[model samples]
Each structure stands twice: as C-alpha cells, then as structure tokens.
Target: MIHCMTSFAQSERSALCDTFLEVGPDAPTLSGSWRTRDLAAHLILRERRPDAAIGMFLAPLAGRTDKIQASLAQRPFEELVDTIRSGPPKWNPMALGSIDEAANLGEFFVHHEDVLRGVDPAARRQLDPAEQKALFGVLSRMGMLTLRSCRVGVVADSPGYGRRSLRSPKDEHGNVVMTGEPSEIVLYLFGRGEVADVELDGADHDVAAFRETNLGV
Candidate 1:
C-alpha cells in the first residue's frame, strides 16, 4: 500500500507538471478569480512552501486574487518554471511524517485532478479508484463537505464499494445522494469541480445549488 501510494503521488506530480508545461505562458484565465496560470503558480508554490525551498512562494499571496496576473507581473513563465524545476531549497523531513501516506496520496491526486479539470478530459479519466478513495477519506476528515453549511449524501452502484453518503452526522435526511463512479465522488467532495460524470439525486434542493455555486468556483 505504501509503495502504491508513493507511485501514485509520483505519477500525479508528473501529470501535473505535464499539464503546466502544456498550458504555456499565455493560457487564458479560468472562470472566476482563478486562471490556468494562477493554478500553475499555486501548485508550484504549494509544492515549495515553508518547509522547502526559498523562492517567491513565501512572498505575499495576500491581496493577490489574480494569481496568474500577479505571477506574470513579477516574472516570466519560463523563469518561474525553471525556479520550480530546481526543487525546494530545504526539503521537509517531517512534511509527510506526521500525516499518513493516505493523506499525501489524497493531496497529490486531488490537486492533480483540479489542475486537469477542463484541461485534459482523457488524462483526468485515468485516475485510479483506490487513489481517489484515499483522497475522499482525507477530504471528509478535513470538513470539506461543509461547503455552504450544506450536507450531501452519495451512493455508488459499484459492487464492494457499496452505498455511501456525505452528511452532517446530525442531519437525518441526506441532502444529496451522489451516485456514480468513485472518482466523481472524490472530486465533488474536494470542491475541485463539478461531478459532471456522476448522477446526483436526493431530496436536496441544495445539491443542485451547491453544484451551481461550485461548478464555476
């Protein structure tokens, strides 16, 4: 399991890197405040935070809603890529120490999917169920399901996986019944994007509303 998680992270990192490369320096801005450039910059900085590296990642991200615009305003894309490719200055020995391998797998895979959304459908379709489940478990623990204070329930038709739902423990009626592939559930829970591939249903008017709000966010 440990080996597989590590391999998954490495694969996700590679895929993210490839996506960044293909985005080039002039990719259009994404809907809302985030753009392709911003997403790339965020990913690179995220990988080089306080525990590692000594580049502009630590500089002020505040007041910089337009991440891509801010990045381009400061430096060119090639320079930024070169800096990121150089790796962090100080690797965190305890970065992945406190958190289990499952958490790390979740971070890499989910973030990879976020970057790939609307960019490469085929590549996004290659995500593994096991890896996605690991990610979903992490997000659930992180309280990501509390978006807009709305509760959601999800059910999968796959065998062995059984039926699952996302709810506020206190709520009786599951707001949303997320039924579909496991990957879609993971993506939906993490707020990476909409679950276009999944079939969501339930006595939850909030589900569609949540989807509407999140799809463009």
Candidate 2:
C-alpha cells in the first residue's frame, strides 16, 4: 500500500515539474493569484521548508509563508522546477518514501491539475483504475472535513468507488450530489471547482447554491 502511494506521489511530482517547464513561469493556476512559478515555489516550500508551509493553513503563520514563498518564487523558474523535480532534500522528513507519499500524493495531484486546467479550462486527464481508486480513497477520507462548512448536504458519487455522504444539509436547497472521476472530484473538493470537471446533480437552485458556497479545505 505504501509503495503504491509513494509511486503515485513521485510520478505526480515529476509530471507536474514537466508541466512547469512546458508552461513557463507566468502561467496561471487554480490556486488564486498563484502563477506556475508561485505554485512551484509552494511545492518547494512545502517539501523543503515545513516551517513556512504551515502558514498555508494557519492564519497567523500565513504572512510568513507568503513572504517565504514570494522569495522562493523569485528564483529562476527553471531552477525552481528542477528543485521540485529533484524531490525533497535528504534532511527533510518528506525525503522519506512513506512521508512523501502520505503528504504529497493528493497535494501534488491537485496542484498538477491546477496548472493543467488553469492553462486550459477544457483540459481533462484520464486516470487509470488504480489512480482513480487511490484518489477516491483520499476523497473518502477527507470528504467530511472538506465539505463540513457547506450549507447543504453533500454526497460524492464516484463510479466504481461507491458513494459517500460527506455532509448533511443546512439549508433549503437540500442535498447536492457531486459526480465525477475521482481526480476531478479531488480537485473540486480542494477548492478548484471552477475548473474541476465535476457535475453537480440536484435541483438547479441547489446545485447553484452548492457551487456558490466556498467548498474546500
């Protein structure tokens, strides 16, 4: 299990690096205000500089994280991509295969799509059965937390992975079912719904409301 996860993480990292090279530095990403260079710096910081990476989720540390990421973003774009492609430094726990798999598989996958869909909204990537199952596993684990703040009930329906009830309705719009390939569902769950290839199944109002609500971690 761990070995599979590690391979997925490593492959996604490598592919994302290749994308960075292809897109250049100024390309946009689903991460708001983040260009490809900014995203690369973020990956570098997350893997190589945990101290700054915490600010990504913590309010108080956000300024510091921003400062550090901005500095890292200023490095030559190719160098940043190279550093990311090379993986974490030996001194970091992320250098360990287990930790890298646990920490980066979903993250790199999401950011990889961020760049892909950001560059072309119509773009889509087909995942193999194993990849789909792996991503669906991530969704099954994180779905509740990711959608807890949503105002309506949420059900995720990924074909071949079974369905999961992520949240209960908090409004009149009722339940909204999100249907998509696992990777697309992951992107939607991570706040990239605008570009994620997911379909919301429910009443028009319910679906609209779900989309309007900020749905992500």
lDDT of 1 by residue, 151-177 (tens): 344333333455544444225545555
lDDT string for model 2 (2-67, tens) is: 445578889999999999999999999888889999999988898888889899789999999999
**lDDT for each of the candidates?**
0.51, 0.85
Question: Model 1, 161: alpha-carbon shift in Å?
Answer: 3.6
Q: What is the Å distance of residue 184 in model 2 from its true position?
A: 1.1
For model 2, name the residue pairs that clash.
Answer: 153-169
C-alpha RMSD for every candidate: 5.3, 2.5
Candidate 1 weakest lDDT stretch, 10 residues: 49-58
> TM-score, each model?
0.64, 0.87
Window of ten residues with lowest summed lDDT in model 2:
1-10
Off by over 4 Å in 1: 1-4, 28-33, 47-61, 64-69, 72-74, 82-94, 97-104, 120-124, 142-148, 151-162, 169-173, 192-195, 204-217
